[model samples]
Target: MSQEKPPVPSGRRRGGLLPNARDIKAWEEGGGRGLRGFLRRTIRAYLRWNRALLLDPWIRYRPAVQLLEGQTGDLQRTLDVGSGENGLARFLGREVVGVDLDFPATVRWSNHPATLLRAIRATATALPFRDGAFDTVVSMDMIEHLPTGERPKALREMLRVARRTAIVGFPYGRRSREFDRSALAVERDRGIELGWRQEHVLRGTPGEEFHDEIIRTVGAVRPEMTLSWFGHEGMRGLRLRWRLQFLISKDSRLYGLVFFPLYRLHSRGRPKHGYRRIYVFKKAAGGKPGDRVRRPARNSVRDPD
Candidate 1:
């Protein structure tokens, strides 16, 4: 008799490592399929948003929509550091460039060049590009993967390379040395590190020293900037439009059927608690070039008691 699959725990998100051999095989084959799926879904979403914008005039200045539109601007040259899979790179105009630690040469970008250069491997402390090599540089949701000590250096390099704009996106909730406390406990108890030998466990609390550090680093570089936050519903609304397009058009059978809704709904967004934080910075145009300001001598300044 065949064995029944175990039930996924209630409230545990789907695709969180509980899959059969068949599922794994399917996913491995579906990696390329998934990328195409997201591209289709995102394009569909853009169309949907376009419709909604036409229908509802009030949303013309919505922060989320505004941010999405901001990503579509004409950039002569862009460097997407830590660009995983180059999704955003596709949206950039013809002059864009991409660099990543893991992308292989086999990876293709028809419009522009995508280079595989590990930020860490190239020189974790210094970037490989000449000064002001790009009009825009973006690092999306990438800083947390770095060692805590190295993040500031990376941010500085990002600032140094961009001529006009630099944006960095990451989870906003907290900056903790131990971002996943319970997960670490599980790893230690199991005597397995998953892949890495160690992992962070403690969540960074609000008003922590790290927040000040990030503010200092980014503020010194891009003093005039904006912050945008997106929740699960916000992302879902974007993806639902994409799904509608796939359903209506039925362009690619495999893509329309399995990939469209799968990406539309599942790729919706992270948990409510795990929403992403986006920071957008535009370099000052012939603006004041002031001296580099160092962060305070202490992690954070304290008022006298």
Candidate 2:
């Protein structure tokens, strides 16, 4: 079977400052004195702020946010399990309750206000909410953080709390395994380790075996809900991004200088083969995984590399 391409959101125009330097320069090219200059700076500040929150973590996970925010729509009561220091709630721009083990002590200096605003001290394996407490539940790039035995448990907790939809994303399947292993080797050679990638090394990304297991679990336990999945960020894309990561690693001060432009260069693209898979399990009002849920609005983007 052929894998599907990444789904684009409906009515998304993606307006803001353009990613290139010439555009930025043109925008700044006038009115240096008086109120107009002040206005220019203010607008620049606002645009920068938006870019920071939305385009940041731009390398690996921006797609997850774009996908989640688009599909969930205007839901108010969403839960993000394993929400980490800065969860999807920050980008979703709504009232989402975030639960994580270490959120309480996470520093607020670099965090957006939304990250800490509704964050709770809890675990994905044991969510505190009653059944159907949220309209949507999302756990992105976090499932692999758990041990093999606990991955399903975390997923179950998300499903248990979600009244309508539960979205889970992780680095899994065969291609993802190869991607991370190569990334680890490249990072190790530089003697610089990305903390999260190290965990991916230790815990190991799941492959086809666990894939079948999850399908069986959902099929047997939540027959009313439906499951669908697709892959994103193929090997070529992953390698290019991984190499870019090393360009600024040796100097903390130079990271932003080098990263921002490359970030713009690599902001959004179609993946040919998905190194990571996103599994969306949605529940219809009175049906199972066999029931049809609205699919995300899709465009003719290429399949993962």
Candidate 3:
């Protein structure tokens, strides 16, 4: 006796991932056919997609945005060190330039939501620029990725290039390090080993000493510039939220879908304990904004600010 095929699940193909052929056929035969139906579906899908694109950045960069925008005038001349995939240009404006040693010649901006980023291949420690080359230079969540010795050099380079300000934001203190460790554990439990996470876990997050060092380094490099820092995103329930994002996997669209809204909702509070900190170093005076700061000479002389 021949056996009958099992019924397919609703809206799903039998033994496959596509929509059920029978259901699609039925819909085409009904009111779901023709130009009117196609237009309706297209508009709906576009709206949903637009919403997702609007929320494409990670929550980690929100404070960076606040700090940059906090300054007077437009962010017309800004340099982003260790810019990676985060589209800081989109938030700040097209005038923003992102430089990173990791960017391959063929590589462009990260597949971020608002992608107006302009990227260049350059090392942070030996930034190919003259002193006070930009109005503002910022490196967000990137210091921890540098080798311990290179961190000071990178910070000095940033200070040297920036005419008025240099900002460094990164996960800070023992709690921040522990938080990253716990999140890495979540990834390991699920057999997920992302390269970025591996580097972050192995390199170690900046702790109390790192914070103090940044202060002392600022004093040494640019004594006239004022240094101020504040911690953000308290630990309570942060792990659970991070665990969900890790399980979803940062490579997935589902992760992008929740990123901005989570930042918008989660960042409004005043939390005593935080997983990250932002340090803003503003020069006492000097310089004007530009559409594009001249890229330094190929063999430009480098110096401390």
Candidate 4:
């Protein structure tokens, strides 16, 4: 005889991992007027705050921050293309004009003291700035989101605007089925579906072919642009550790208790093929010089932080 499938939990069936339409409907139906609802909302808010402040900085952002810190040149006027919520700006510790397609209302702009400059709403393919506008341009974890054909254009625009350096970071190499399976198992065991978001538009391995494409595109404009790769290493135990930490962090803020020790252990050794890679492109010789002390327009919104 055929057996029936197990019924999914309301949270899973409705929202999968993050809060969804159905989840919002249910919460609204409950009115949040009763003591239990009030308590639930309060607890959730507290946990979210803790995750944002204590956990995300170390778990989600530390690698990129470390990479930038290691490679950054003399700090001057800077632009961060595709700077969603300005994560890199936090590590920069200075004024950086950020530009992205959209900025959600929920982001805490004031949290990062270094993001003192205004964030502009713009596109990566067509930055709304003049040529050689800034000394450094940073675009982290943003390129793979564009269509394969458009990636080259985005890179060209970044290089055109950067007078000295341009840094780009994204998931590199082939997508590992083994790693995907392990992550799925962890999320299943944790009773959550972590695949609710569809962020990576370009699929398949972003390996040799992708690197060659970038080189060809950048070469067209700045033939002498020096290209270098950082964090090119093996996966080793990094994937499993990352999965475990993500699952644990969902349960409580106490995950922070174990975060640093694990980070130190894993970070001590380099892998042969790391999941992420950073590309640094130094300006070609005889390129147009950058405009020092030039600021954004007076009408641009400026963050006082």
Clashes of 1: 5
User: For candidate 1, lDDT tens digit of each residue in 112-196?
Assistant: 5653322222443477888777777777645656767777788788877877766665544432223334445655685746432
Sorted on lDDT, best first, the list reads 3, 2, 4, 1
Worst 10 residues of 2 by lDDT: 296-305
Q: What would the per-residue lDDT of candidate 4 be over residues 116-227, giving only the tens digit for each residue?
A: 6567889899999888898788887677677777778888899899877777876676543245455667666868665421334224335667777776776677665677
Cα lDDT listed for each candidate: 0.48, 0.65, 0.66, 0.62
Candidate that scores best on TM-score: 3
lDDT per residue, candidate 3, 130-201, as tens digits? 898888888877888888878878888898898887777777767777777877887789897867767777
Every model's Cα RMSD, please? 13.9, 12.5, 10.6, 14.3
Provide the lDDT at 27 for model 4. Answer: 52
lDDT of 2 by residue, 146-265 (tens): 888998788777778887777777777667777778778877887866788888888988776677777777776667887777655566655675677555452333345555665566
User: Candidate 4 overall Cα lDDT vs. reference?
Assistant: 0.62
**TM-score (all chains, Cα) for each model:** 0.48, 0.70, 0.71, 0.65
The 10-residue segment with the lowest total lDDT in model 3:
287-296
Runs of candidate 4 with Cα error greater than 4 angstroms are 1-74, 106-117, 175-197, 232-234, 264-270, 284-305
